[model samples]
Target: MSAAKPTIAVVDYGMGNLRSVTKALEHVADGRAHITLTAQPEVVRAADKVVFPGQGAMKDCMAGLLESGLKDAVLEAAANKPFFGVCVGAQLLLDHSEEGDTPALGLYAGQVKRFPDGLSDAAGARLKVPHMGWNEVWQTARHPLFAGVADGSRFYFVHSYYMAPADAALSLGYAEYPFAFSAVIGRDNVFATQFHPEKSAAAGLKLLENFIAWDGQR
Candidate 1:
């Protein structure tokens, strides 16, 4: 008998860019996995894995989450199954965000803050806000999600704020700006990234493939 395909629930909290994420996951899985973009609490709870991808301000995202009554459902899913968060969705896993002074899901430690001087070289030229375009990510720790990925690979990035986890050990990847910041993070069954894996091309697709193959046991 064939093994059951994992159902990935891409949470739709009104703040996420779900279309691209859904398309990317579908492409990576080659139709082997079931992907759903939904705002229903029951749908999230029933999925084998959950993905929270967002693009927007911290305050607005949190507000949508609460108003939808999907916050508790998300926490429950993360506690019991494999969970992934991207960009602002990943930032929301922390205790709080300096953006709009909003409280987060507190699933992980530390806080989120904006890039002080924006991206800068050693000489200190302003690289601009939003931190748009592609950047290299240096893998810092071993995780199943990075199974076939190389140490230094370029991924698509577009964000202004970054996360500072209470425990550096939880960090899986780093990228340089004026200084290095956490690029990917994983702890137990939860995984997150500051970059957009959907937009990262082949390397990003590999990451998604690993997530789909994960059994959530380790």
Candidate 2:
């Protein structure tokens, strides 16, 4: 008998850019899995895998999750299933964010911080606050998610604040924005990225494929 198809839930808490995230997952699923964009708490609880993708302010995102009653569902998935977080979804896993001084889900250790004011690159040219465009992401640890991704493969990025995990051991990848910052992180059944793998083209797709196949044991 064929194995049951895994249901991957893309949580819809009303804050993130969900269209691209949902479409990207669908494309990568390729009949190997079922992807659902759900706002219902029960549906999230039942899924085999969860993709928590978010875009915009940390305060609003947390508010939406709380009002929708999806926070607990997300916490349950993180503790018990193959969970993936993208962008702000990744940030929410941390203890808190400096953005509006928002409190996070506290799933991951450490705090989210904004890029310091008066920052400049090596050339002394002021770096943009919202770090945009494509940048090289260096794999810092071994995990199934980066099976085919090269060590210094470039990925798409769009964020201003970054998460600074208290434990460096949680980091899986780092990218340099004229300096080093974490780009990927994983712990137990959970994995997350500051860069959008969906927007990352070939390398990103490979990572998604790996996630789809991963059994979450690691």
Candidate with best lDDT:
2
lDDT value for candidate 1?
0.89
Q: TM-scores of all models?
A: 0.95, 0.96
List the candidate 2 regions with Cα displacement exceeding 4 Å. 1-4
Q: Please give the CA lDDT of all the candidate structures.
A: 0.89, 0.90
Candidate 1 stretches greater than 4 Å from native: none
Residues 58-86 of candidate 2 have per-residue lDDT tens digits of: 99999999999999999999999899999
Which 10-residue window in model 1 sums to the lowest lDDT? 1-10
- The clash numbers for all candidates, in the given order, read 0, 0
Q: Write model 1 residue lDDT over 1-218, tens digit each, in one string.
A: 12478789999999977999999888888878898999999999889899999899999999999999999999998788889899998999999999999999998888898888646788878788778888999988778888888888999999889999999988889998768999998788988999999999899989998888887655
